[model samples]
Target chain A: MNIVKLGYKNIADRPLSTLLSLLLLTLGVGMIALLLQVNRHIQQQMENNIRGVDMVVGAKGSPLQLILSAVYHIDAPTGNISLHEAEQLRKNRLVAAGIPLSYGDSYKGYRIVGTDHQYPELYKAPVSNGRLWQEPFEVTIGATIAQNLGLQIGDTFMGTHGMGEGSEIHDEHPYQVVGILGYANAVIDQLILTATESVWEVHHHEEEKSENHPGEENHAHEEADEKHSETTAHDGTPGEEREITAMLIRFRSPMAMIQLPRMVNENTNMQAAVPAYEINRLFNLLGVGVDTLSTIALVIMAVSGLSVFISLYNALKDQQYEMALMRTYGATRWQLVWLVLQEGLLLAGLGFLLGILFSRVGLLLISGLMEARYHYSFSGGEIIREEWQLLVASLVIGLLASLLPAVRAFKINISKTLAYD
Target chain B: MLITRSLTFSYDHRATFQFPDISLEAGTDLLILGKSGIGKTTLLHLMAGLLSPGTGHVELMGTELQTLSPAKLDRFRGRHIGLVFQRPHFIRSLSLQENLALVQYLAGKRQDKARSQQVLESLDITHKRYDRPHLLSQGEQQRATIAMAVLNNPQLILADEPTSSLDDTNCLNVASLLKQQAATTGAQLVVITHDHRLKAHFQNSILL
Candidate 1:
């Protein structure tokens, strides 16, 4: 009996046109919603991982790669840096803590990061069970590694020669899992951590045995017996021969932000990359792609708005008799206008809701693919605060699209329309 | 009561209409006779306040419609006048009873389902109450149109060609139903149509 009911029925009277407009609106809004969720989650993860580390010191290469390799553990290191020279830079008065990373191997695609206890402390990843690695070849698995590989406290696995899964297995040196770190939303959650000496010792033993008996079968078993004897006298100390992939540095004070990166880049052989600068550059490069996608989505939204306007205008032309009849029954012209406008709002409102649901399903599918490919988890169920702004924008589009049609309804000639019947 | 004085209207000044002055007391019936294209529907629209006259005032129950603002005129028309068009144009989505209920609602009255049912019963279309407007026969739709006109118990009921397309029997039935509903509601009835068959039905008639 209300105008809303009348409006709803009028919309229902033309199901095909309504469905077409709704489909267009849903596609536009769904694309925008999907982009918002994905971009927010990526930005959040990047910000979370780059919290403690102020700068990364690694072999000279793309500074962005240095941050991605050291902070995110997602890219290859630029090259190796001398551990003794790196230690000298770490001793600068401005340095708070400098944790070295030496990773040349992985077990089933999970990188084995060789570092000190300060590495775990930086990410606040406490051992949930058992204890941290205290000796070479004794490793600590991250929460994701343990859950994925079914590695318990006493499980033992041999590292591969390269970072990927299909490299040569270092059977001469087996790493025993001494602890499993708790879940932390940082790079540590996907890494296998151990003392830097373990990386050096495994490579040193393999080099010596290969040189002594080249291409001999079963030499790895013999080399395992010699692993203890090949350990350096100063086991955990960084020496001339020892090298690391990168060093993650935190500043002692804000003064370090200005002087430290410049000093290391100019004076030392290592290149110092500021994490914030590299990540900003990376997001700027990514922003272009995301902005292009958003523009396309906006264009689609504009097209849908046109469709809504066209359909409403056509419906007004078709329903002139009905409108005149309503006027004859005591409905004001403005009431007729409101009826048309309400139909537009109802269509947009329903389309927005359906678009949000469509985006959620799209996010679920994208998250599943991301998890399978990158081992990165994105809980897409988190609500974006910007969606409310999107809702308001959608309503504005609805309102604007119906404005002309509503005015046409307001100016209808009731006498002429009724006379035509 | 209803009265008008020298009502006139034109579109583009090509065919101007100067309507005759008339008055009707409460609870009485009047038939306005005119040939097709003689401004009969336009006159009905003018009386219902759907169209404003170019030169005169339509006064219903002592309120001059032309003097009121468009908004106030609409409210005045809703509360005090009822209109029925040539074709029965109920909100096609609603059933017969709901259409009458909608009439009351649009007139700013509380929806009384019982009153709608009573109106339907009085018109002997209570069996078609729950049916959509398109589902009803021509005679039933006309009765339902009358039911809507009387839903607000308005002071003046204006029907524009309410029986133009009906046969002899159906036309007689629709005219009687309009008069019966108008008399029962104590409203002055005005039926404007070109059908000469209705000339014998009303005591007060005007020809154009």
Candidate 2:
């Protein structure tokens, strides 16, 4: 009965073209929104997990891989560096806190990392259950690890020799979960924390068992050199030249940012990598693909706008006399103009709503895939600020697409049309 | 009363129309007969205020419609005048009742559903009020069109070739219905057409 109802009926009468425009708009907006969401997730996950660790020093390899393995615990470590040499580097005045990580073992596909209290302190993850691990074989599991593997406090489970499932099981040295960590929204939530000596002693026990029982369970260590276990003063246990996977270092001042990384690379066998720098490099390398995808989405959106224009234009041509009839019934030119514009705006608004739905569903599917592969849950259901701008852009498209058509409606000659065109 | 003097219009420099003076009192009817190319529709358009004449005066009930602003003229026309054409056009998307409501709304009147139903009933087409215009028969459509025209009860009713496309029986029915509705509303009626069948229905006749 009203202009809005009239405009809506006009669109509803032509379902095919309306649906086509909506489909294109939904796809374009959904693609851009999904890309924006994933980029936000990756940036957030990287930044939060690398908070206090200024640099990583590991055995010589790719600096990016060293940061990925030592800091994120998502990649294989760049070989092992000497613990004695690592301890000597930490003694320097420029280094404030050095947390050494040693890991090559997994229980149920969750990596078991051997490090000190500094690692938990860096991510501010408080032990929510019993306590932090204090002994060689006792473990404090992260929240994700505890939930995924269904391990509770005081539970004991044997760890495999390598980083994933289906590796050699070291059944003799079953690790006990002494505590469970609270959620920190960091990489620690997916790790199992134990003392540095646990990784060393597990291999030590394995080596001796192989020597006595030789050639059984020795294939796992056939490439590793046998270390001489003499009584060492470090922990009062018989040990060899101990090795660690990497050391995560925090600086005493900003001066270390200039000197520390270069000094480690030049003066020692270890390589230093800055987490912030490496992550930026990673994004820079990925930015080209992101740009290309964004351009495609924008192009699709423009085409949807064009489709709206064509549909409205064609409908207007067929309804010229109907419009003239309205004018003769005392409707002003502006009223007729608004009728057309209202149809365009209505389509744009509907397309935007459907597009948001498309993106959120896509994000959930990606979240499930990420949980399965990387154990990083990007459960982002909140709308970011960029979509508001997208909403404005969509309205603009509707307006621009209807501009000429509305003008034509405004300029309609009532006499010529009603005289029966 | 409705009056127009020295009305002139042109689509271009080559095609021009200068209409004769017209005046009609309330509760009476006038029929204007002309051949196809004699500007009968143009004269009706000028009097309905659907077009601005090159030079003229169109006055209805002491308000000079030609002197009003474009927007004001539209409102004046919506409030004071009703127009009908040969094909009995309507907003095809709306049902018959909705079209009447739309007309009432455009004329700055309240959407009086009861009044619209009463008008359609008087015209004997109230049974088809819920149907779309395209779904109605030709006689039913003409009656619905008359129902819409008189829904506002305007001071003037103008019809341009209103019965040109109808058969003899339906043509007399529509012409007499227009005259009866105008007499009921106490409005002046002007019918311009090439169909001479309408001459018998009006008291005053003019040939252009």
Number of the top-ranking candidate, with TM-score as the measure: 2
Runs in model 2 with CA error above 4 Å? A210-240, B123-131
Q: Indicate the residue-level lDDT of A307 in model 1.
A: 88
Number of backbone collisions per candidate, in order? 0, 0
TM-score of 1: 0.90
lDDT over C-alpha atoms for residue A50 of model 1: 84
What CAPRI class is candidate 1? medium
Q: Please give, for residues A1-421, the per-residue lDDT of candidate 2 as tens digits.
A: 7899889888987899999999998998899888999999989999998899898999898899888877887777778887877888899899998998888787887888889998999999999999999999999999988888788998999988765576678898989999999999999999999998788888777767767787674566533222211111233443336788889898999999999999999999999999999999999999999999999999999999999999999999988998888877778888899999999999898888899899999999999898888788896578899988888888899999999999999999888888865
Residue pairs of candidate 2 with colliding backbone atoms: none
TM-score of chain B of each: 0.96, 0.97
Error of 2 at B87 (Å): 1.6
**Runs in model 1 lying further than 4 Å from the true structure:** A146-151, A216-238, A254-259, A266-268, A380-382, B12-15, B93-98, B124-131, B135-137
